[model samples]
Target: MILHLPAQKIPIQEIPIDKKVKLFIKREDLIHPEISGNKYWKLFFNINTYLAGNPEKPYIITFGGAFSNHIAAVSAVGNLAGISTLGMIRGEELKGKWRENPTLVFARRNGMNLQFVNREEYRHKEKLTEFLQSEFPDALIVPEGGTNKEAVEGIKMMLNDETKDFDYLCTAVGTGGTISGISEFCEENQKVIGFKAVMDNSLEETINKLTSKRNFSLIDSSFGGYGKIKDENIRFINDFKMNYGIPLEPIYTGKMMQKVFGMIEEGYFPENSKVLCFHTGGLQGIEGANLLLEKQNRNLII
Candidate 1:
């Protein structure tokens, strides 16, 4: 069963930070229930292509962190498609307490076989074939973040028939797969700016090796690091809701928008430059963020 979701071109709204500047959002967040945002497109075509070519392969295995949306999405979609899925999760054993992590809970409920691996082995996920061969020995291995060449090609379909005349195209960078794919499809005159959610130099090298586009630049705008948010980011999250009536989670889209606003204030973006921001969905994180906000409110009350 192929899931279909219409791409929404969210209206360009003028920023209160700068009245002269306009920001447009490509709402990939509203894509689908299981296949949300670019995650759907990234994994969908790759899985379909693999299955079609190799009908003998009955199971697919992938790797991710405990709270990874990719794992959750893959588990749900794979179950629906009648494919047995395995999730190699990074961390110590949490056999009985997996429900504490929402993504892990969902993945388990969707029939994903979970295996725990330490951080040391998880870092060497690129050589997953050896690990899987020693372990499952039969399942097809998918790279962490679903960032293979097939995944990049699948994500490129999201830009089909859209106007590519924008000055800047911005996206939240997780594994640099989506940005690298977008960079490949963008025109030479267009600039692709990626907001790195994690503080690391390796991601830049990864993207550089993936695409040969000189117009692409990855910014280290991570508010501290991956899954880490400061007070300033919380304020930006609040202001984003107030100004645009759109709620951005701190982990992904919030940081992207925060950096975009900061660049606008710093006068880094050229005047009257059309900016297109991609909203990579992570709505599951909202529960944790809201709980933190409530704790802060209670502290102020006390």
Candidate 2:
């Protein structure tokens, strides 16, 4: 199952902000309908490398939350490649209630099997991964957010001659793969800023180990912890979409962008600096996010 990346260059559009720093966004979200953005590139080498070996049974096993974009993307890869997929979903309470979740529903429609596990078990994923690998030797078991060495290698494709023109490259850091790749392959003069979506304290060390150079810095962008969306976040997402004609999901992109804007307002960036942020796509999770927001009687992302 050879998945060919789209031949066209992803567009980088300038965000006309009144701030002194010039802001632009690389539309990685426009890469594909299902496997869009960094997810596509992160899985590029992973799935392709696994398929190159030509295992007798091509199966993919991965882990994620109920609304995890990684799970959705992996399921899409399985669907596209005609391979079987198993999703180790966190929260055993969601076992009988998976139908209520959009991401899980999409994975099911893509022919992916869902396995519900308790939080304790999910917390110790290394043990679970070992067991699963022993059980299914032929399966390609991707990490929680596809943040392995191969994934970093795949993320290198996100940078190019066009991206090199920027003084600072930015992205929403989930499992550190995207930022690590940018830090690894970016030019010496360019700095990389990672807007961390999760408050993982060990993320800096993890990302540092992934890249040889120390050209990246991480800032907390978790408005109210991971996956806990705030009213301000929804408002920012809605307003940004209305103003820019670009959609951003609540978890990663929205938070990252909101923080970036805040930093600009605080004069965190120097005057005349060119900043480019990668739109690491996870738009599929927006449906589930909106469903939760609707239940809470709040404004939905448009």
Candidate 3:
């Protein structure tokens, strides 16, 4: 079975902003309904490259937190490629009751084996790799968030002739693979701006490790941190959907868009400067995030 092709570039469109910075969203979100956006790019090469040269058929095993978009994407790819998928989930509390976790439930339905680990145990990747190698000897281990060299290769194609005219390349930074990939393909004059979806002081160096180019800068737009949201962000997301008809998940695209609008308002960009915003989809997590928001009596995303 063939995995969907990379470089599924969506039509570019301009959004009217007060500063007239010419902000255009390159809709990577529309690449696929389930395995949408950057996740698709991140997993594309990892699966293909591994399957190409391996003599022994192997199950795919990867890591992710409870609400991980990576887990869902890998599961879908495994189903498409006729490979068995195993997810080493972060929270041990979610072991048997996978159905209670929306993302895990979807993963299970897609035919992924669920293995839960405590937060402490999850931190040690080397140990996790050793353990998996011993148990699932035939497992092709895809790194957390699939940010390996092969994954970056697929992501580089996200920018091509159609997206070459933009002055800046922008996307939400997760494991830094997407932005890293984009930076490598960007022109010298084109600046790559990555807005962090999670707040971590160590992220700048983390992103640097994966990419050789120094043309990119990482900004903290993480509301508070990953999964944390402000009321204004929620309001902006709802209004954006009403105005543009493009939905954004609270975790990633929402925070990045909020930062972009703020930059425009503050004149961070020069007048008439063109910006390309990568719509890396995490819309699936909205349903689960909204559930938590409702229980906390916080303002919900539309």
Candidate with best TM-score: 2
lDDT of 1 by residue, 1-302 (tens): 35444545533344445545666777777777676777887887767766766656668898888778789878977778888899989886766667777788788888999988878878887676586767765566778888877777777765744537578889999998898889888877888899999988898888887777767888988877898767778787887787777767778889999899888878888778888888777766666556555766621100
Show model 3 residue runs off by greater than 4 Å.
6-9
TM-scores of all models?
0.89, 0.98, 0.95
State each candidate's clash count.
0, 0, 0
Q: How much does candidate 2 score in TM-score?
A: 0.98
Query: What would the per-residue lDDT of candidate 3 be over residues 1-302, giving only the tens digit for each residue?
Result: 24567454476777766567889998888888788888887877777777876738668999999899999888888887778999999989888777777888889989998989998999998799998889878778988988888878889757878788988889998888998899887888999999998877787787788788999988898887787778888998998998888898888998899899899888888878999999998788988888778988998878
What are the Cα lDDT values of the candidates? 0.77, 0.93, 0.85
**CA displacement after TM-score superposition, residue 159 of candidate 3 (Å):** 0.5
Q: In model 1, which regions exceed 4 Å deviation?
A: 1-18, 133-138, 288-302
lDDT of 2 by residue, 1-302 (tens): 45686789899998888778999999999998999899988899999999999989989999999999999999999999999999999999999999999999999999999999999999999999999999999999999998899999999999999999999999999899999999999999999999999999999999989999999999999886998899999999999998899999999999999999998999999999999999999999999999999999998989
Question: Whose TM-score is higher: candidate 1's or candidate 3's?
Answer: 3
Ranking by lDDT: 2, 3, 1
Which model, 2 or 3, shows the larger lDDT? 2
